[model samples]
Target: MCILFATRSHPNYELILISNRDEFFERDTHNTCWHTNSSILSPYDMARNQKTSPTNSETFGTWIGINKNGRVANILNLRPADTPPNKSSKGKVSRGMIPFTFLNTDSRKDSFSEWDSFEKFEHQYPCLTTSGDFNFFYGDIKSKSYRIIDTFGQTFKVLDQNDNDSFVLSNNTFNIENTKKWNKTEEGMQKLKELISKTKNESNNNIILMECFKLASICSVPEEIRNKPYHVDPAITYDTIFVPPLGSNDGEDIGLTITKGDFYGTRSQIVILVSKNSKHVTYVEKVLHTSDRDCKTHSAINPKDFHQFEFEIE
Candidate 1:
């Protein structure tokens, strides 16, 4: 996924994750669904070329997911410009493998500790490797602990639940230290903070929370900033379609995907809401269909794949 919004501390919920997975519309992917591996049922993904592994028939891998332990892990692929490109692309592990490795482990901390040593993991599976350039965010709601593995920043930022409750991460570096990411950081944070403010004075309500996340998922930058007389990537400007929260007929039927005739637009949406004192989480994922901007037949093309998995967090 390219864009991620997460809040660890909420007045009514333990955690909230609103994410958009942006990729080329042509990249084939399986529907996000629950899978059973030794009786553990969680949302899983299968790569386009499902022959990569024997378990591909059951559950392949995922870029982001939550386990039974209230532990959530999501990764964002760093753009080629953000880091030096790999010289030899002969062999490499899929980014989705990390979540599977973490969820299958008995101890979450141990799994992370093992992940900290990237070299050891690379040694085990020569082809299963990451560039150490991706942004890794994981946290345990029950433990009230979270951390961001900032490969671009070259630091492991440990976040206290009380101290830092909300965060927004995109394909670019999100800190002011890097001049390249300053504008995006400013715009994204503003929209996120607005969502936080809207839900601040309310009790635990899943519907309200979903709407808040929708706002984050579809928020865009100002026209003046977007149309600035400069050569820049449009993805940074965040011009995307808006989808209404469930149970509302307020949005357009074809407004599911970011069909803006550009590269790396919003291809899918994954929204997760975990309420405080609740055993399960509400998970919704929708992978939208590609549209033909010229034909105006986009409404006929609904989401190509959609899945909803609501279950206990253990």
Candidate 2:
């Protein structure tokens, strides 16, 4: 239950990632911070863990994160669309570990341009594949190109200068090359392109982030559908950027054990902008809903309410 829009087409910025993290409000999460014993910047999912050691002092995994080296990784989960799968969390891997592994490790000191760079990295940490399907984009942001692994982890592609001006992903979209994607995904991509074109000659970064937040908050999910039972599938339930709170009834047919009145929706919105020089970065996250504060309806968004950070590349 997530949506991301990214652009490498902008002249002033090397890469821009606009993301929405949608999940159940009941899940406990920590705000973004500099990871312990590492240069990675990411938030922790207190509910999921990898049990790396007996003490498990290692920080829990994450959904989106970046390293001081300018490497970034963001993940979106995929569900069994047509059929219900085993709902047991036993022996299952947490998807947050995928990004946690990537962001914590260092890239090749030589160059990430090497073809074997990602392959060796992926093999170095086998957590690349998780319990369920996922779609992820990761690479050194300075490169202005991202490698994507699709839902089934079968298709792999790189977004470069010659490709589309922007790329968008949701729980939908089997592959980046695939023609079919959620209309909401298409809308985000189009809006990103427009934003890039409009800000081509502009120098202000705030303008860029404002537009990114606006794009992240746009939605295609109808009010009627949102008011209904929530599912992870694009066609079944989640097909929008800003997901409003939807109730879950512990649907057994769908393998969801959520009890009555447990709501699922977008919990946070993130925007990361890496300047063309690649040394400067702007990161912002706006918390919308949580287990304590459940915003059933969308309200006016303000940037001042967001958690903001700026970091220089190491």
Candidate 3:
């Protein structure tokens, strides 16, 4: 299960967002890199199962990204009915491109920034989102404005800057007023609040980043529960933040193909910190597996080696 957590509660930072990207060990992924063409920074998912739209000429799509203009965009795939996401079967759309579009076209004059108004945003973006069921988060740190579009629910939410709260989204609905948060979301929020308290006196950004990594790695499912036939249960998934490969030990060719991609688990972790003044952004990503090769040649690829970068927001 993939999870994303963002906090505006920090005293020194405007936003501290961390995410755990869970996927099959075999999925091809491009490690975090700066896009020289667009001045955007993000990793790319090369799953080309879906038919491409005219706007999606590029073969790769992005689940999360940030631009030099201080726009941040991310997505969560609402936990499909199938265990390993059934990549080859029924998915007609690539959800990552929603965030990719946001990061690329968020210039103020470009109607993308009009996301603050529900009607304007709804009128503009629903066409792009009509094919997929997803949760998209778009934020302009320079404007201190954030908005969430849930294509599944057709709901538009503008995150209140004045709230100064931590928001956590897993595979569940984020209508905080109408729905109860999943255990994972609640626990993430509480842990984030505690992190804010514990690091109140800390000055080193690196330490804070490490703590965020540890915070995202809270994934440990009981053997009894994990060994059982995998169910698409949110409680079972939300039980922990990190997920180890399932059915890998029992079988040798566990995560060999998209058809045999049952070795589902957390593959990468991302932590992004934006300064309170919105002048700088620190982006860090640690890739645990780029392909099945990393699983066997563990020592060759240092999993904890983070692709880290800092950029001044223009």
Candidate 4:
């Protein structure tokens, strides 16, 4: 599970993205790496290659990333009911590949029309028909456009940047007003609104945005509810719990006990800011802890282990 927040209409920035990566701690995962082509910081699953694979594997990490082309993609698993049966199911394609796949290709200016003009998306990407349901938000600076693409290949473009300046995406169903259906949807949006209110015109404020993301990531659920399911609550699902998969048995023990053999909590946090005028991108990654492969004891480390960089889109 993950939570992604983005603001597109700020005075100083074209976009601001805040994300928390939640997953099993026993799996081998790398924090961030600058891709060979450009200054794209892609946090990859160390265990698998970039190809079609089962979603349950360790390679199923990272649902967000930004490229040097000034294109950004954020994906979330759609609720089963929201996704209809695929008419073009070829086979299972890794849902994690969506962001990177978009980044690999340059975006066109016309938005949805150009993409839909193709004879078949399943033909273009054989996995699209068979991949698990996903909600993808993609934007490109060159195209000056942003939109959401669902598993069914439906696209909803953002016509008014000001109206849809800020958006929060969690595991719950997609709703603009953020109704009080799921526990995290209302609480997370409320916290984001409060933070946005505090810094009214302060665009591209990474520090405050990072803090807001941390708040949403760590916010506790109600105590009245017993037997809290992690999927229903972002607090438990995205909690910053890091466990190294090597050396120490502590990580395995914590994973077994805390999540009851399910995936662990938040492993990494990323904050990205893109400037509209200059098209310069600022990316910051906070790796919560070092793996046991590097440190034997699986010791607790500071969240300040940040890897940051800035680059301009050519």
lDDT of 3 by residue, 1-314 (tens): 57898887777888888988877767777888988385789998876433457776555667888998888988886643233633322134567666776677646566445665435555555545453556677788877778776754454555465674668887655664424556677788788888889987775899999889888877567756553335334446656777655444433322122333545667888999988888988999988866555555441135735689998998
Query: 183-270 in candidate 4: lDDT tens per residue?
Result: 5555565666676666656664566556644553553534343222233332344332222222222223221112223334455677
Worst 10 residues of 4 by lDDT: 240-249
TM-score of each: 0.69, 0.84, 0.82, 0.71
Which is the better candidate, 2 or 4, if ranked by lDDT? Answer: 2
Candidate closer to the true structure by lDDT (higher is better), 3 or 4 = 3
| Whole-model lDDT values for every prediction | 0.53, 0.68, 0.69, 0.55
Candidate number achieving the greatest TM-score relative to the actual structure: 2
lDDT for model 1: 0.53
TM-score of 4: 0.71
Candidate 3 lowest-lDDT run of ten:
251-260
lDDT of 1 by residue, 80-152 (tens): 3333333222114455565565555554445444444334444433434443246667666565556665443
Off by over 4 Å in 4: 51-62, 80-91, 107-113, 116-123, 175-180, 201-206, 222-263, 289-301
Best by lDDT: 3
Name the runs in model 2 displaced over 4 angstroms: 80-91, 108-121, 143-145, 173-179, 223-238, 251-261, 296-305
Residue 274 CA displacement from its true place in model 2, Å: 0.3
